[model samples]
Target: MLSDTSGGTSGFQWHVSGEGPTDNGVGSPQPEEEESASGVSDRRAKVTVIVLCYINLLNYMDRFTVAGVLPDIEQFFSISDGKSGLLQTVFICSYMFLAPLFGYLGDRCNRKSIMCVGIFFWSLVTLASSFIGKEHFWALLLTRGLVGVGEASYSTIAPTIIADLFVKETRTNMLSIFYFAIPVGSGMGYIVGSKVNDVAGDWHWALRVRLQHQTSHSECFFSELNVSLYFPLHFCCSPSFILSTFGFTTVAFVTGSLALWAPAFLFRAGVFTGEKQPCLKVPCDNSDSVIFGIITVVTGILGVASGVQASKKLRTRTSRADPLVCAAGLLLAAPFLYLSIMFAQASTVATYVFIFLGETFLSMNWAVVADMLLYVVIPTRRSTAEAFQIVLSHLLGDAISPYLIGVVSDSIKKSDSYMWEFRSLQMSLLLCSFVAVVGGAFFLATALFIEQDRHLAENYVPSGE
Candidate 1:
C-alpha cells in the first residue's frame, strides 16, 4: 500500500490511504487470518458506527442548543424572533461556506485530528455561551460561526471514514446508523436545554457561566488554546454502489432540506402555532413526545428490517448494484415532500401526518448517500469526496433554502395579509421540487451510464505508477 502522507500536517501525518488492495473491483483485500472475515467485519462496523454516532450526537447538540433555548435567549437579550433566527442563519452560512475549505483540508490532512480539534473548539464555544454579554452580539455570532467550522470538519470527514471502512453492500445501513444521530441528538439537545432552564431558572443557559465568572482573564486565555485528541485504531468496511446512486441521492438531499424548513416557515409566520406550551414541556408527558416515541420505535424497526432486506436484495442483483431502486426511492420521496410542506397548514392532523411522511421519505437518503459515497470514491479520497459532498449539499442546498425562505417571507411581510407571505414560502418549494426533479433525472442517467462493477469504475487504480 502506497500511503499518502502528502496531505497531512507537520508532526501529525496519517499513514492511511483511501484505496483498497485490489486493482480491479473484486473485493477489499484482507489479512492472512481472514479466511472467514465476517467476525472482523462486524467488529469494525460496530466500533465505527458507535464512534461516528457519538460524534454526530455531540455535533447536533452543539448545533441546535440555541434553538432549544431561543425563547429564553430572546427574553434575556431582548432580541426579536427574526433576529434570533439569524443565529441559525449565521451558523449555517459559515457552515456551508467553510465546508469546501474544510473538505479540501480534510482531503490533504489527518481527519481524526481535524475531528478532535473541531469538537473541542465547538464544545468550548458552546460553553462560552455563558460568559458573553448581550452587548457583545458580534462575539456570540463569531462563536457560532466558529462552531460551524468544527461541525463542517466532523460531518465532512466522519462519513468519509465510514465509507472507507465499510463495503458498498453495508454502506447504506451503516450510514443510516450514523444518521440516527440527527433526531436523537436534536431531540436530546432540546430536551436537555429546556429542562435545565426550567430547573435552574437561569435565563442564561451556559454550562460554563459560573466557572467563567470565577476564572481570571489570563486563565481563560490559556484554556482556550487547549486541544483534545481521540484517534481510533482499525477501519470499518463499506459496500459499493453505482454513480447513479450519488447523483440521485444528492438530488434527494437538496429537496429534503427545503422540506425540513417548510414547517418552520409556517411557524415563523405565525400561520400555524399549533399550541405553544411552556418551555418546560416534558419529553415523556407531552403528546408530541409520546407520538414521537411511537414513531421512533416503528421507524427503528422498519429501518433495521429494510437494511436486512437491502442486504438480501444485493445478493440477487445480477449487476450487484441496485441504483435503480435507489433512484426510485428519491423520485417517490420528492413528491411526498412537496405535498407535506404545501399542505402542512391544512389541518393539525394533516400537518402532522404530512410532516411524518416527509421525514420518512427524507430519511431514506441517509442510506442511499452513504452507499453512494462508499462505492463512488476510492478509500483514499473518500473523506475528500465526503467533504466536497458536504460542501455541495450545504452550499447549494439547506444553507441557502432557509435564508431564501426567510428572504421570501420578509419580502412579502408588508403584503395585505400573512397568508400572502406564506404563499411566497410555498412557492419556494417549487424551486426545491424542481431541483429534486432535475437531480433525479441526472441520477437515473448516471446510474445507466455507470459500469457493471459494484464499486464505481473511477475508483479502481492499478498499482505502482
Candidate 2:
C-alpha cells in the first residue's frame, strides 16, 4: 500500500488512508476545549506543550545523568577512555536507527500513545541499569542502548505534534519552550545524578532516583515495539532542511563532546594546575560536572531565548531570518570555543567565561533549527523529517564525537600521566571549533534556499486522505 511519488515531492510517499491523525478530523472529536478552534484549542495546545516539555526534560535528564557520574562509573568498571565513550555511542546508535520507524508511525498513528509507550520502555531499562553489577559493564551498555527506543519515539513525534498545534510565531515560541528542556534537563541530569551519588555513596542511585516518576512508565515503551512491517524509506529535497541539519549536527557533535568530557576536562585542568588531585579513587570530584552543568543551563536559556528574539525581529527585514540567525550563532561560537579549550590549562576563570560564550552561541540553533524544519516541510512529513535529521545528525554528530574524541585522546597520550590525559583530551576537543565553523557555513548556505523551500511547503496539499 506504500508507493513512490511521480512529481516534485522527492522522497514523500503517497498518502495512506484508514489511519489519519486521530487528533484531527478523525473518529470522535476531543472535548470542546480540547478541540475548540482550528481543531486544537489554545488551552489544549498550551497544555500539550507543557506535557511534552516535561517528557522532554525527563528524557534529556536521564541521558546526561551518566555523564554526571562518569568518573564513578569509570572507576567502578575500570574502563579506558574508548570504552567510556562507548556508553554514549551505543545509546545514540540505537536511538538513531529506531527513529525512522517511530517517524513513520507518528504520521499515521495516535502521537500521545506512541510517546507514552516509548517513555515507559526507557524507564524500565533505566531501572534495570541501576541494578547491574560492576563486573557486568556490558549489561549496563545494553540497557543504555535499549533506553534509546523510548527517546527516539518521543523525539520524532513531539515536534511534529507541536507543528500541528500552532502556526507561525506561536509555534516558534512553543518550540523554543520545548527546547529549553535540552539544556535544563541536561543540566539537571548532571546536577541531580552527582548529588544523588554523593548522598548514596554509589553511582547506582542516580538511575534509581529517576524512577521516582515510574508511574509514567506504562505510557512510555509501547511505541518502540509497534509493528511497522514495511516502513518506506523517504528523503527531502529541501536544501534548507538538509543544510540546517548539517549545521545542527555540528551542534550535536560539540555538545556531546562537552556534555561527557567538559566536566572531566575541567577536573583534569584543575589537576594539571595543581588545584585538585587526580581521581585516584571512586566517586571522585563531581564538582566539575555540577559547575559545567550550571553553565550549560544558564547559557542554554540565554542562547535559545536570544536566538528566537533575534530571529523574530529579523523576520521583519528578511524572509531567510531563521537560517541567517543560525549561521551567525555558530560562526560566532567557533572562536569562543577555541578560546575556551586553550584557556583550560591556564586560567579556569578564563576557560569558563569562554565556555559560557561558546555554548550560549552554540545553543542558539536548537529551537530555530526545529522551527526551520517545521516550516520547510508539510505537516504529515514533519515526523519523518525530524527522524531523518536526528539520524543524520547523531550518526555523523554526537554518535561519533564522544568516541572519536576518546580514541584520538587515547592515540596521542604516551602514558597514564595526568598531564598526558589532560593534554590529549584538550587537543581532541579543539576540533569542535573547526566543526562549528563548518556548521555555520552550512546554515549560511541554507539561507540561500530557505525561502524557496518554505514557499513550496506553504502551498503543499496532500494527494489523499
Candidate 3:
C-alpha cells in the first residue's frame, strides 16, 4: 500500500493505498496539529464557562438585592405584607411568561447576541428603577418586571451552551462552578443592599449602585471578551419531568421566601432592630446581614463543590446518581428547616445554626439538578426544556410563596394579640419544612426514571453539526 504522508504544512494527513502497511502505525503522525486544536478547544470552553458563571452571578445578585433591602422598601412604600410579597410575584410572573419566548429564540437565534441584549436590557431597566420616587411605587414594579424579561433570555439559554462545550462528567463540574454563584450572589446581594442602604441612606441609591456595578461588569467582562467568542462553539425528561418539576417548584418556593424575607424575618424575630434612618450615623446594626452573608457564602461554596464531587463519583457507579443526590439534599434540608423555624422564637443563635445547616443541604441540589437536565434533554430542545421548567417552577413555587407568607402574616396580625405579628411569620415559614419533604419525595421518584431517560438521550444524536 502507498500512503500519502503530507497534504499541507499546517498538518500531516493520512492516505491509504492497497499497496502496503507502514512499519510503525496505520496513520501518519500529526501530534502537533491535534494538540493545537485540542488546546484551543479547551481554552475556549474554559473561558466560556467562566463568562457564563459571572453572568449567572450578576443575575442572582440583581434578583435578590431587593430582598436584602425589603424592610426599607416596605417602610418607604408603607406597603402591607401581601404587597411586599407581590413585588417578587410580579417579577417571577414576567420572567415565567417571557421565558418560553426566549427559549424558542435561543434554539433558533444567535444565543450569545440574545444574551447580550438581555443583559443590557435588564441593566438599563435596573438603572431606571433607581430613579423611581417613593410616590411612584407602580413604576418600580414595572421596572422590576421588565428586569425579569431580560433575565429570562439569558438564564434559559446559558446552560445549553455549557452542555454543548463538554461531555457529561466535565459538564457536571462546570455547572457546579456556575451555580455556586447562586448562594454567593444571593448572600452578597443581602450584604451589599444592607451596606449600601446604610451608606447611601436610601434603598433607591443602594439598588442604583449595585445595578450600575453589574452593568459595568457585564459590559467589561462578558460583552467585550465573550460575546464575539460565543458564536463559534456549537456542540451537544418524563416522570423525571413531573417529579423534578415538582421538586424544583417546592425548592423555589422555599428559596424565594427565604431569599426575599429572611433578613426581615430575622429582624422581626428580635435578632436585629432597624434604625429609623440608617444613614443617621450609620446606626443600623448590620450584624444580622453580615452573619447571614458569611454563613451563606461559606456553606454554599463548600456544599456545591462537595455535591459536585459526590455526584460525579456516584455517576461512575450508577446512572441514578444525580437525582439521588438531589433527593438526599432535600431530605436532609427538611429537618434543618424545621429546626431553624422552631428556634426562630426561642434562640437567635440556634436559629442561625439551623439555618446554616439547612442552606448547606439545600444548596447541594442546585448544580446536580441542572446537570441532570442537561443530560436528559437533547441538544436542540434544551432551551425549551429550561424555559418550560422555569414557567412551571415559578408558577407553582416562588411566585406565590412570598406573597402567601405575607398574606398569612398580615391576617394573623389582624388578630387582637400583639405576638401574632411575629408568630404568624414563624408559622408561615414552617410550611417550607413540609414542602421540603414533599420536594424530597418528588426527587426520589425522579430517580426511578432518570437512568432510562439519560441513556436514551445519550444514544440519540442530532443529524446536523
Candidate 4:
C-alpha cells in the first residue's frame, strides 16, 4: 500500500488508507493485501458497497413504511397523537441506545457475522409484528423497538467499512452514492407501503412486504482480525466531530418529524381547506403520501450529488470545504421550510413547491456529513466515534422530535375541529426551520476546526504517544 506520511503518524490510517496508518513512518509496505488471495479486495469492496446501499435503502423503507400507513394504524388501534408518536420514540430509543454496543462489537468482531445475526432477528420480529391484532398496539411498538436492534447493528458499522475501502474524492463519490439510498428508501417506504396497504386492504401487509427486501440484505463479507486489537476508544472530542454531529442532529430532527407526520399533516391541511374530507373509514386517501415520496426521492438524488460536487470543487481551494457546504445546506433549507409551513393552508401547490426546495437543500447534508466524520476521525476510533455520534444525534435529534412535535400539536388542539389538527401541527413544525438555522450555525463553527481536526486524525497515534 502506498501512503503519504509527512505527519509520521503511528497507527495505520484505516479510514484514509489501508488497514491502518503507517507505523512510525517505517511500516512495511504490502501490495494492498493482494485481494486476500481470493481476488476479492477491490471487487469485494464494490460489491459490499452495493449490498450496503441495498440494505440502507430497505432499512429506511421499512422505517417510514409505518408512517405511510400511519392513519390506518391510528384508526385501527384507536390511538392518540402521543401513542402514534411513541412508535417512533421507542424505535429511536432502542436504536440510539444500542448503537454503542454494536460499535464496540463492530470494531472487534467479524462485521459480517454481526449483521447476519441482526438481520435474522429483525426479520422474524418484523414478520410477527404484522399480525398483531388491533387491541395489541403495544405489541406493535415493542416489535418496532426490537426491529431497531437489528438496524443499529448494521447502521453503526457499514460506513466504517466503506471508509476502510476508499479514500479522498473516491470515498466522497461512494458516500454520495451510498447516502443516496436514504431518500429513495424513505420515499419507497411511503410509496410501496401505502400502495401495498391499499391493495391488501390492511396496513399489516406493509410490514410483511418490507420483509421481502430484508431477506436479501445479508451479503456482508468483511472481517477485521488485523484491523485493531486495542480496546475501542471513546468518542473523539475534536470540535469537527462535535459540531458536525450537532449539525446532523438537527437534520435528523427535521427529517424524523417529517417522515412520521408529513403525510398526516398534508391530509389534515386538505381537510382544513375543504379540498378533502376527514377520514370516515380505514385506508384514508394516500395521494399526499405518494406525492411527498416522489419529492423526497428526487431531492435526495439532487441534493447529495450537488453537495458532494460543490464540496469537491471547493476543496481544491480551501480545506474547510466540507463543513462550509454542510452549513450552506442547512442555512439555505430554513427559509424555504418556513415558507412551506406558512403556505400549507392557502395553496397546496405552493406548499409542495416550497417543500421541494427546502428538502432538496436539506438533503445536501447527508453524504457530506458522513464523509466529514470518516476524515475527521482516525481509523481505529472510527467505529466508536460513529457510535457516540449516533448516540448524541439521536439523543438530541430524532429520538424526541416526533414525539415532541406530536405532544405540542396535541396540547394546542383544544377543539374537536379537524382544522385545529392541521393548525397545531403547522405551528409545531415551524420549529424545524428554527432548528435548521441552529444546525447551520454549528456547521459554520465546524469550519474553524475541520482542517485542524483532519490533520490530527491523519497523524493520530492510538496510544503510547
Candidate 5:
C-alpha cells in the first residue's frame, strides 16, 4: 500500500500494486478524505488571491502618493518642475533595472516569501524617508528608488501566482478584481496624501502616514498567510516585452505625467482659484483631487468589470477578444483625452466629464491585456515575461514622461508669460491623445498575433511528455 499525503489533512492510502487493501480495507478513498482534500485546495486558492489583491492595492497606493504631494515636495525643496519629475523617473529606473533579477528569483523561489521581503523592504524604506531633512534630498531620492526595487519583486510575481490558481475564463474575472486596485489605490493615494498633508502640515508626514497604514495592513495579512521562509533563489529573463512595450510606453507617458501633475496643473490653470499661502503649506482647495479620485475609482471599477464581461462573451466567439477589446478602448480613449485637454482651460465641468469618459475607456485594457499575457506565455516563463514588460513599459513610458513634460513646460515659460506657462502644460498634456492613438494602433496589431501565440502556449508539452 502507498500513502498519499498530497491531500494534507485528508490523506489516503492506495494499493499501488492493485493487490493490497487500502487503509480502511477498501480499494477506494473515504468520502471525508476526498471532501477534505478538495475543500482545502479551494479554500487555499481563495485566501491566496484575497491576500495578493490586498497587497497589490497597497502597492499602487504607495506608488502614486508622492505624486499626490508633488507640489508640496517641489516647494519644500525649492525644486523646479524637471527636478520634481525626476523623482519619479529615478524610482522607475530603479524598478525597471531590478525587475529582471526579481523575475528570475520569483520563478524559482518561494514567491510568498519573496513578496513578504518586498513588502517589508519598501515599507521600511518609506518610513525611513520620513526622517530625511530638507538638506538630505538625495537621501530621500535613494529611498524612493529602493522602494521601487521592493515593488518590482511583488508586482512581477503576484499576477503569475494568480494565473496559476485559476483557469482562463475565471482568470479574467479574477484578474479584473486584482487590477481594479490600480486605479482605486491610485485615487486613494491622492485623497490620503492630500488629506494627510492638510492635517499634518508637512509632506514628509503625509508620506509617513500613508506608508504606515499600508505597512500595518500588509503585516497583519502576511502573518496570516504564513509564507515559507526557506528557498533557494535562481535567476532568467520575453518578446511581448518589446511588442507590449510600445503600446504601454505611450499609455504610461500620459498616465504618469497626469498622475504626477494633474492637481498641480489644475491649480495653476485656475481651476481651484484658492488663495496662495506662504511656504507651500496652503491647503489648496481639494475639489480637484477629490473629484479626480472619485472619477478614477468609479470608472476604473466599472470599466474593468464591463471589460471582463465583454471579453468573456467575445472569447466564446473569437480568439481575438482580448486584443480587440484593448484596441477599441485605446482608440475611444484617444478622442476623449483630446477633448479633456481641450476643455481644461474652457470649462472645469466639461473637462472632468471628458476625463471620466477617457479613463473608463482606457481602463478596459488592463485586465484583458494581463489575461492575454497569462494565456500566451507558459506557466514557468510568466514571471520573466512580466518582469520584461515592466522594464520596457516604464523605461520607454512613465520614466521619461513626467520629466519630459516638465522640460517642455519650463521651456515654454522662457517667454515669461504666465498664460503661456499654462498653455505650455496644456499643450504638453495634449501629446497624450496622440500617443493614445499610437498605442491603440499597436494593440490592433497585437490582435493579429495573440491567437497563434495562445494556441502554441496551450498545446505546449514538457520534453518528457
Candidate 6:
C-alpha cells in the first residue's frame, strides 16, 4: 500500500509511500540528482513538456476554430440564439461527461498514445466541418460531439503524462508553457478561420475539413487505455470516482452554455456585425464580416503571446501559486473585455487595447490550473486529476455561459434588436469575471496547502506501485 520517501527511489513510490521528503517526495530528488551521475530525468521532463505543450495547442485550436467561424454557422443554419447555444453545449456536455472515463483510462494506460489519437481525430473533425452543408445540422452536431470525445481523451491524459515527467517545483513552469496554447491555439484557429473565410466566402468550410494522419484510432486510444488500466485498478477507488464526476459535471454546465450564446450575443449586439450605431440601421451582410474576424484573429494572437510571456516570468518569481497574480490578471482583463465589446462598433486603438487585454487575462487560467495539477498530484494520478479539472472547469465555467446569455438576451427584449444583443453579451462578462475570481480564490487556498516541494498531500498517492 505504500513506499519509503527517499529521493532516489524509482516508480510509483516517488509519490505514495515516501517520508522525510515533504509534499509527495517530489523535492527529494533535487539534492540527489545534482550529485548523481544520470541526466535521464531532466531529459525526460523536457520531452514531456514539449509534447504536452503541442497537445494543449492543438486542443484549444480545435475548440476555438468553431468559435472563429460562428457567425457564418449561425447564418447558414438559421440557428436561433438558443439552438446556437446548443452547438457549444452539445460538444461541452459530451466532453464533460466523457472526461472522467478518459482520465480513468489515462491512469491505467499509455497516455502519450491516447493524446495522439485524440489530436488526430479532432483534427479530422475540424476538417470535416469544412464540408458540412447548411442543412446538415444533425451531422454537424454529431461531428462536434465526436470532437468532444477526442478532446476528452487528450485533456485527461496529457497532464498526467507531464506530471509523470516533471518534479513538483518545476512542474508549474512547464505547465504554464504547455497550457499557454489555450490562447495561442485559439488565436491560430481564429486566424485560420478568418483567412479561410476571406478566401472561400464561408467560415464553416474552414472548420470542417481534415488532414492526413499516419496512424489508426484503435491503436492509439486502446494502447494508452490498456497501459493505464493494466497498471492497477486500486487508483480508481474511493474519492477519485466522486471527484472526477463532479469536476466534469461542473465544466459541462458552464462551458456548454458559453459556446452557444457568446457569439450569438455578440452578433446581436452588432459586435459581430462590426457596425457602430444601433440595430437595423445597417443590415449585416456576409460582405464585411470577414474583416472583423481578421482583426479579432490578429488581436487574439498578439494577446496570447503577451500573456504566455508574462505568465512564464511571473511563475519564476511567484511559483505559479500567487492568487494575487491571477486576480490581477483577471481585473486587468475585465476592462479590456468591456472596451473590446464597445470597440466592436469601432476599430480604434481603444478597442484593440480592450480586446488584447481581455484575451491576456482570459489566457492565464488554464496554464495556472494545469500547473497546479501537475504539481499537486502524483505522476500516476495526474490523468485523473486532469480529467477532473476538465470536467469541473467546463461544467462550471464555459458550458452554460452561452446558453445563459442567450436565455437572458431573449428575456430582456424578446426582439431582434442589436442594442439588446450587445447589452446581453456585455452582461455575460460579469459572470466570466465572477468565475475568474472564484478560481483565483481556489488557487490561493490550494497554494496555502502546497508544501515547499510543490505537491499537496491532502489527496495524493506516491508514484510507486
Error of 5 at 133 (Å): 2.6
The root-mean-square deviation over C-alpha atoms between each candidate and the true structure, in angstroms, is: 9.3, 6.5, 6.8, 5.6, 5.2, 8.1
User: Over all chains combined, what TM-score does candidate 5 have?
Assistant: 0.87
Per-residue lDDT, model 5, residue 231, is 19
The 10 consecutive residues of candidate 6 with the worst lDDT sum are 221-230
lDDT of each: 0.52, 0.84, 0.75, 0.85, 0.73, 0.54
What digit string (tens of lDDT, one per residue) describes model 4 on residues 55-150?
Answer: 889889988998998888988998888789999989999999999999887776667788888877888888999999988998999999999999
TM-score per prediction, in order, is 0.69, 0.89, 0.85, 0.91, 0.87, 0.72
Candidate 1, poorest ten consecutive residues by summed lDDT: 218-227
lDDT of 5 by residue, 1-465 (tens): 233332222112223434434677857654432111112255566667788888788888788888877767876777877787888888989998999898777766656677777888889998998888877789878998999988997898888777766675667777888999988988888878777878887777767876665566554332111112221121111233245556766777778888877777776666323232223444445456666777888888977887788888888899888777877887898899889878777787888899899989888878887887777776667777788778888898888888888887887775645567567778778778888899988887777777667676777664531
- Estimate, for each residue in 151-215, the C-alpha lDDT of model 1 and write its tens digit: 88678767765554455546656677777776565555445554565666663563433223222
Clashing pairs in 4: 11-21, 12-20, 12-21, 13-20, 13-21
Q: Rank the candidates by TM-score, best first.
A: 4, 2, 5, 3, 6, 1
Which candidate ranks first by lDDT, i.e. highest?
4
Q: lDDT tens string, model 3, 40-98?
A: 24666677788888878888878887887777787777777788998899999999999
Summarize candidate 2's per-residue lDDT along 119-154 as a digit string, tens digits: 778888899999999899999999999999989988
Whole-model lDDT, model 2:
0.84
